[model samples]
Target: MNKKTSSFLWNLRQLNLNICPFGSSSIRRMMKGDHLELQKPKITYQNSILKNLLLLQSLQKPLLSVRFFCQGVLVFQLEGSEIQKRRLNTLTSASVGKLLYPRQLSSDSQCFFMSDTTPHLAVDGPKKMMVPLEHDLSQKEKQLDFVKHRHLIKHCNSMSDVLDIFSKFPRFSSCNYFISMWKIAKNMSEDQKRFERQLLYEHPAFNQLCDQVMKEAKTVKLQQVIFTLYALIKIGIPQNTYLVQVLLRVVQERINECDETCLSVLSRTLEAMGKSKNVDALRAGLRLLVDKQIWTLEHILTLQTMMKCIGKDAPYPLKKKIEIKALKELDKFSPVNSQHMFGALAALNHRSVILLNECSKMVAADIHGCPFWMLMSILQSCRDLQYQNLDLFTAIADYVTTTFDMWKMKQVLALLLVFESLRFRHIGLMNLFLKRVVDISQSLNQKEILCILHIYSSLNHICDSENQQFLEAITSALNTYLPKMSSFSLLKAVYCFCVLNHFPQEPFNQLFQENIINELLTSGTESERTEYMLHQVNACLELEGTSVLKSTAITLRECSSAPFRSHVDIEEMLLNLLENKRLFLKNVQLPHNYFVDFELRMDSKRSKVFPVSEADAFIAEPDIIRVALLCVSRSAFCFGTTHPRGGLGIKMRHLKALGFHVILVNTWEIKKLDMSLAVTFLKNKIFSQEAFPTAPGFAA
Candidate 1:
């Protein structure tokens, strides 16, 4: 018996067969027969598996039946996008694969849902994606012919078989033959891929079939055209060919007929040819298709395609639709796909906590097999969304630690950027990264070294005896590239050095020269950001870099724009409560051009709030405590965690540096409490004896 037949029998033996149609040779014949089949082979186990119900509904074929077991159901469809889903719970080795006959998905297909645990189709053909049964007899006869051809196509397992199938039905089965060939090629080992590439690269018949596929692009189904295009690119077919040009014109004419999957295919096809303008056009075309096709993401491939189409700049409403649709199919998402979805959404600067947290669960569970790039993307997303799941980070760190030898410096730098931006620290990962980076310090580029210095400057970058070696290695690398950098970048690098208290001797002369100082103050690129960096650099020098730049006085002008007002519920309520007491000052400008959420001057003895900026000279008294309420939103903290992000840390540090007592007001928490209780919470937090120490300009 074949493995499918054997597994089917073992599954029958594990469950009661009285109610199952498989008591006969039905499932067995379905496994090995020529008729269309969707088989999910079940495993045999020691414990007895339960089967309280086994329902089998026969369709046209004697052996063909839609089967479901109490303990077994389909977790995913095996055939077309229209097939229904059934659950096979606790089935460890579950994969849905099918030998589909040539025919459109019939009206019998259903969208599976459940009232309780047992998976079932509540309704059939809800979206009408299936073919109608009202076609004439000749059409059905044509379908029968297609099915026979598809059966022959299924037996194809090698590149030679692909050639035979293409020659037999070059018009009808060309798409399937291309897909089959790619499947065979992808599963091959390195030697196999090399041999196959040699076997097919210059074959005379391959060129004829390539011309056939390009000709078929005009009248064939748009779906087949796209599939053949993508598959041809994946195979050894030269990308810069007339075939791609012909298909490109055809696709442009039929752009509206393209679905989400086709859009993604066009994206990949154009990407392969380096036809970026066409890819951008396809991205622009998405705005029209999104509304109608957004809800049709039923398969993993479809979802991934939709994700690529959505990309970073899709509108928020469209992104929200993708998020909701993704959430429904979340259980079916593979680990890499899940992280890819997260990365796509996060890149748009849109975040869904439910989605982020769910994907994190999947990533943490599948740590060992997850790719380092996917892990880095998740970290970047988490950092973008201000979500820090330590469990996920720890799992990724362990995974990277195991696979450290395979990582490139660019990927390691990306990890450090995420860690630095998120204000996260991993002692072990850091050590591994430091050692690797130090060993390759000679090969480091200007951008890479600046990234390292910035990370160290934001993190625990105290230059102690133990840290001396790492700091020196980074500084040594920076010294080589500093002279080549622009004035703006050089200024930022020195600011980071001053923050770390690691003054390299080479760049100081170039950084403080009159010409460089003028360029730093007046450079047009990133002017506002450059001004802010200069302001901080001036402060860093006043506190730390005093020995140098004594003769050169850097101008400190406030480029601080008016911060957008937050209308969040907690902040509004807090502002109202304090406004009635005449003590809440909105948008109070602090000493170093830092704008606060609200400033409250209160009596230390009586805990009474008062306004000191007014004519009241009571502000001069030492009994008053100046409190700056930093109303932080939910996004300000790490996603799903309570830790504040790196940006918030900087704001708090700057507030404290200006001698204003900083209080981080978590709006998400206080927004839940009643007004009376919230007042009590605020009072206790503001007046309690506990005090957070004044942090350094760049706290390690």
Candidate 2:
């Protein structure tokens, strides 16, 4: 290296490690090439970013580049000024090309691949003869409509701000518009990427762009074509099959011509394809192309993108191949990038604990530094594996509760669901959700409303003022949406009410209408949940003074039961209690297809067992207590917590409304008990007080 350049690099390396905490190994390896090579450094795309910094140091540079952005090797930011931001923007546009700077800005959390060598795929294949690049295409692109509308497009903040501009795309303007708008959109924060992509997908010009790109496929510049495909995906793809095939063909035809820069964008586009889960686009073989080209990729951005693309859908052999590659480049896999690999691994339906632990360590090591999205993914990874890490979850809870406002609605839903799956709860987060949900309740989609109903109901949220408002909003929204909701969804909505111990009379009135009831009965046969709801809804309605909604189409006895049973020992012990204390029937299936551990009818004061065949026959007699011995195993709970799952709670509620004095024989509490203790435990559950305990509030 020349003395001047060598001294500059030496100074960069000698910066205080305690302050920056970034390793320069990649930088050193990149810079070790001869000065001639240093002029055009062979570092991967991520390093190319740093190389831009090396050159742009002549313009201006910030210390540690604003919180040590190590390019997926455990880095974050401190928010630089507008000048530094502009300087960084220039550095990015100049480095990764214009199409990418925005995507890179969209979310730092995305998995990227990087190959130091940047090899083209299938070297042994014969190279095709190169066609001379079209001269007319370049000249025409300069005068495209985007150049004319550049001033107006620059001031466009949201996608709506540019709908008029998008509609005004002249005959030959799509390529420039696609390229320029993507660059402009790059300036949007990461969250807006999802929204704007949807808007662009809905625009008429998107179709025009697709047709235009297909017509110009052979003549347009390769980067323009590749980046346009990437942008089409970011905005969201229309259901256009031909467009995917045409783009796939262009990519295949241009495979050998792709350099590292081209491959970086290509790999990224493939990553988006995988994430978007466009079956047609993937079937177009761009996914297979990435698989074929996997060995050639060494860059972290490219590799992570490859892992992200493979996800769980890739076959076992390919997953193993990429897994080995990930392990080999483990250092390059940051907590965020490692998350993609973890997601892929978990999707295999196998828990790779070693990898799960490794990922946990990365996040735990810098839990405070992890972004909202990254923590959510880690929780998801834990959820998929059924892995429990209290420390990690606690750290995440601490961070998320304080910054609760930062989460998007769907992300918040996912996080809460993950927390439920993990059996972890944070009061602050729950309160925040309840409060936040009420504000946005009016705007939720049908699926989202159902999800909210499930979330709050399953969590067994107390009906505080905030929660009541949220539930009221949800139910009101459902009532408004009833005309549009499918018959099955109406059943689900009613079931959510039953789970919460209420009759959804308003919706139920509409639901019991002849046509909708028939629709639900016919369509509901295929689903276990639907079948359960059919019986439970009717039972709940009747117990609430409404008439039965069951029609001839419904067969109470013919409904499918889960066939799941409790442990044999637990069942035996519970039978012993019923036999020893009271005359009782063992293993009775209720009218609702619910299997009771033991069913024994008693007078209302529970002084003695009765021989009534049907428990409710004596319901009018205040002296009757319909005892249903429910053996609730740990599996029936929310996995790790003592709280019964929603289904269990629902069953208890149904039993209560049937005039049954529900007594829960917790499997865990009696697991270590002898027969005498088990009998005592059973007796206590029945005669504990005047009002028998229902649900998990059973005798201690």
For model 2, residues 459-481, the per-residue Cα lDDT tens digits are 66554657556667777777778
Measured by TM-score, how close is model 1 to the native structure? 0.57
Provide the overall lDDT of each model, using Cα atoms, as 2-decimal numbers.
0.61, 0.60
Candidate 1 local lDDT, 209-295, one digit each (tens): 766565456556798888877777777566556666566656766778986667677656654554355555655665557656767
Q: Which stretches of candidate 1 lie over 4 Å from their true place?
A: 1-227, 232-242, 245-299, 306-356, 380-390, 401-409, 419-428, 431-443, 458-469, 501-506, 547-552, 556-590, 595-629, 632-660, 690-700
Which 10 consecutive positions of candidate 2 have the poorest summed lDDT?
Answer: 124-133
Best by TM-score: 1
Who wins the lDDT comparison? 1
The residue pairs found clashing in candidate 1 are 73-86, 73-87, 74-86, 74-87, 386-639, 387-639, 460-700
Estimated TM-score for each candidate: 0.57, 0.51
